[model samples]
Target: RRRGGGGGVETAADFARTAPRAGYLHKLGTNVRQYKRRFFVLRPSTHLYYFLGPNDAEPRGCIELDGGGVSAVRELETMPDGRFRFEISLGGDGGEGDAGGMDASFASANDDGGGGRDGGGPRRIVLEARSAECGREWIDSLRSESLPYVRAELESSRSEADELRARCAALEARVEEMRLVERDRDGAV
Candidate 1:
């Protein structure tokens, strides 16, 4: 009998053995680390993760299913004409949940001519942006401008706060010393 109710007991391995219940075309990928709170799925094959918003000048990275869970490790790049190319590998035997079906998952990543069908077929997704600066160029801007600006502001504030704290500590110590002197004088009287 099934441990829960409807069927028999199933181990984690059993769930892993099962195939995807249904095929999902053009599933986007997202990460809380690189893309912040934004969640977007790129083409399935490429699994490209494009960060959207007025501030997002370029797409971030991609996510791949290592096994049961997803991993955001590889990075995706765009071509001269705004097209993207994602190349990753699936380790071990090419089985049910292997990366073979990734082509259909990211179908939007392909061109209209369908000429760039690698070995399997066109990627299942493309994850186009409503508005985006050039790909890598935009990322460089973030590093050169936004991040540096934030860091500098934080450092300056921290230094000021630290100096204030030190001054307060010194004043407190002086007050305690005066209190002891007053106590000694009173005791003598």
Candidate 2:
């Protein structure tokens, strides 16, 4: 579950076991467009978390790549200072609102330019990888992990919809029975 303050706690051993990728990456600030080096960890659960450093107990923020949280991931043809860079486009709302598990202070601190929360368009986070191979690996892993989470979410939604449909049908049948009883009473009179 996503909390409003920070990411879930994970010990070093547990983080190493659960995280497929954990390293330093330069993240472009949303408000200023300036790149800042951050320690990033990609968990098996399709959550990409970045912390102030590798030893931080909690993440500064989390990007949920499931249930329409992420829209696309692509490499940029132009390189910034010859770094292998890629952009992850977020879907509507981008899961960065009140429920995205991003610390309020962190968001406000980085978003001093006042453009971060305008909700104007899909939010994109650009990341610079250390090498071309690493960039490709990150892209592939993100794509692969995201699909299973999205599929699971879809399946859950379908099951809920089916249950709702069955309930609606039952209610309609009861209403019809009530109408028939009323009609019989009126005819008897």
Report the C-alpha lDDT of model 1 over 132-188, residue by residue, as the tens digit.
343333223222233334467789999999999999999999999999999999999
Clashing residue pairs found in predicted model 2: none
Candidate 2 ranges beyond 4 A from true positions: 1-14, 78-81, 97-119, 148-189
User: Candidate 1 — which residues are off by over 4 angstroms?
Assistant: 1-145
What TM-score would each prediction reach against the true structure? 0.26, 0.60
The candidate scoring highest on TM-score is 2
Candidate 2, residues 1-189: lDDT per residue as tens digits?
232345666433345445777788778776576878877777665577676776665556667677677888899743655579887878765443222444565443333121133367667778888877788888888886786655787899999999999999999999999999999999999
Cα lDDT computed for each candidate against the true fold? 0.35, 0.68
Worst 10 residues of 1 by lDDT: 19-28
Sequence-dependent TM-score of model 2: 0.60
